[model samples]
Target chain A: MLFDYVYAVDMAHTAEHGARKAGTRKRADAERNIAAIITAAADSLARDPDASMTDIAKAAGLGRVTLYAHFPSREDLLRSVLAQTIAESTGIIEAVSPDEGQAAEAFARMIRSCWPLLSRFGSLHAAAQRALPAGEVRRRHDQPMAYVERIIARGRAEGAFRTDLPVEWLVTTVYTLLHAAADEAAAGRLATDAAGEILEKTLLAALKPE
Target chain B: MLFDYVYAVDMAHTAEHGARKAGTRKRADAERNIAAIITAAADSLARDPDASMTDIAKAAGLGRVTLYAHFPSREDLLRSVLAQTIAESTGIIEAVSPDEGQAAEAFARMIRSCWPLLSRFGSLHAAAQRALPAGEVRRRHDQPMAYVERIIARGRAEGAFRTDLPVEWLVTTVYTLLHAAADEAAAGRLATDAAGEILEKTLLAALKPE
Candidate 1:
């Protein structure tokens, strides 16, 4: 219902902003198909990084021909997933708006808010990390990492976080723990709520000054 | 050279005691073959969790017949990897002997000793986790977990660590961070030494009393 309402609004806005662009049904349909395929592939990859082209196609409820039409190869499909991951990660960081409030509280808030997405996207991220070199993955993840680094630097400057470590190390450790929380959840060793709570508490305690 | 010396000594001892068990060249050759295959498979799996049987065979410089002779299927191969992982993890934890020092120091020693092995064998462990159910992985990992948990409990008892959280949560968080450290190393985001130092410092800080 919410999507319908929002999508309806989007359609009206797009129609007004550029009717020629919005009026192209064939182009719009292709765009929708690509989005659906990418979303399905992301879900499949998150479940199993080695998910096959056939599996992805099946998951998307698209024919093999259609999937192949959009993505000529598995690498192409993975590229789309990488793009989605980068965009989603940046969007999540932006939405959390880590610049607000006390740096410590802000950091905790980011962890709490980011846990679900981190865990949900865990496999996709891991898959991307595996497929790409660290340098490439880092480059793609630069914006989000920088956003996190800024918040952590602020926390360190405010004397909330320890001053002994570099901001990169601190941010990396936070991400590592976040990924760990996601692994715990995915492994069913910890429920999402429990994982988030433990992570938030541990990270807050660890990152805070002695 | 070590294996040859050990094998010679074992043969002499067995001849003096009972030769039947140690007398066969075929059996000894089979044992060596199996060991080599497992070691190679571990390496290949660590490099690529979905490493194919043929790829493992090539890595070990063995034939399909020999590889299949040892592990009938991918599941069987993965089961061996899981066993190897369990044994190695247990050995690392036992070697650390978390009972030997102040609980915090013991934890650090454990981290320092385990980091190299953990990062090296990370993909194999991840593959095992994916192959086995969580309960099975936990069961296999229980001994090591218990060892870490014992140290954390001692720390809490001695009032060196926080007491508000359950020991299980503390121990889980520690392993989570360790795995994260391993991930960082594997991803090349942090060098092994740096990852270890950051992880040790951060973990000790987090688990210690406020």
Candidate 2:
């Protein structure tokens, strides 16, 4: 069932790209086919952790040799797909206006804005988490950590949060809850809105004046 | 290296079982081998999520079919090992005698006793969490959750904890922190002892009189 859903989404994405390319008449249909192949390969890989290169090519409606021509190896394809997903999600983060109101409110808004992107790219995130070296994951995570840290510091200065706990600890606590909430939602144990609410309440509790 | 270690341990366990089958002549040898197998399997699985069954059988000096006769699937083997590990850790919880001490002291003692277990089993727990059916996992988890609920209720009754939050919420919060701390320690981001200390402080902060 999961595989079928993912495959359908991949097909839809490919169709959309084909439509755009046909409208532009700039690139050949071959470019559109290659895009579809990459999308299918990524979709298959996401569904099956142990999917082989041949299996991915089959899913992409291409021969194994052709798939290799486009992507030299499984790792190469995986890395390329991951890079594209990361770039797309990064664009979402950049598109959000982070200066809406008080620091806490603005931070929450930013988180809300990013939630859909996170949900859509969850499989990519999981793959990146498992495949990347530990230091690389930490390095990539630093930006979000720094953003939350700054928000907490601002909140403390504004008297919106208690000054007792160190900002780093608060940031860690919030991120931990956020990660937990995301996991629960992804596992379908909790509704996304419920998970978000839990996060909000937990963060508020942690920040409350003592 | 991992495969060899597991094979050696399995061989020891098989020898131990053979001794047990004999007229008590090699009972001690059999016991030692059993212990070795369990230790090896636990250590290897902790390091490699995809440790092979053949390697485990070789480690124990048993045939692959024999190992399957003992454990039907990877999930079954993992669950059996985890259950034993959990039972050993629960001994500490039993020793705490939560009813005999002040609320704060009892809570601290409980944390100290369970901290190591949480740390050691963190990754296994995370994996089992992803594999098991939610209903089955929750059933296995009910006992500990009930125990924690009782402790929180007792604390509230004694005026050591605030009454505003639901006991379920408190239980969830404690469990989340315990798992989070375990993850941090496993990831090498924090010392093992820090899990206990952080749990102590976080619980104290959360439970204080309103």
Question: What DockQ results for candidate 1?
Answer: 0.22
Q: Any idea how many clashes model 2 has? A: 13
Tell me the lDDT of model 2 at A58: 84
CAPRI category for model 2: incorrect
Q: For each candidate, C-alpha RMSD in Å? A: 11.0, 13.4
Residue-by-residue lDDT tens digits, candidate 2, A1-210: 999999999999999999897877745555765787767865664544345778878887888887887777766776777666556655665566553458778667766766665554434444444454433444565666676677778878888777865565666676655655554455555566545555555567666666
Report every candidate's CA lDDT: 0.77, 0.65
DockQ of all predictions against the true structure, Cα-based: 0.22, 0.11
Instruction: Give lDDT for model 1.
Output: 0.77
DockQ for model 2 equals 0.11
lDDT of 2 at B39: 60
What TM-score would every model get versus the actual structure? 0.72, 0.62
> Where is the poorest 10-residue window by lDDT in model 1 chain A?
A129-138
Tens-place lDDT digits, model 1, residues A1-210: 999999999999887869766668768888998999999998987877667889999999989999999899887888888888778767877787789888888877777777777778756755555555334555676777787788888988888888876566677767666765665566566677677777878877777775
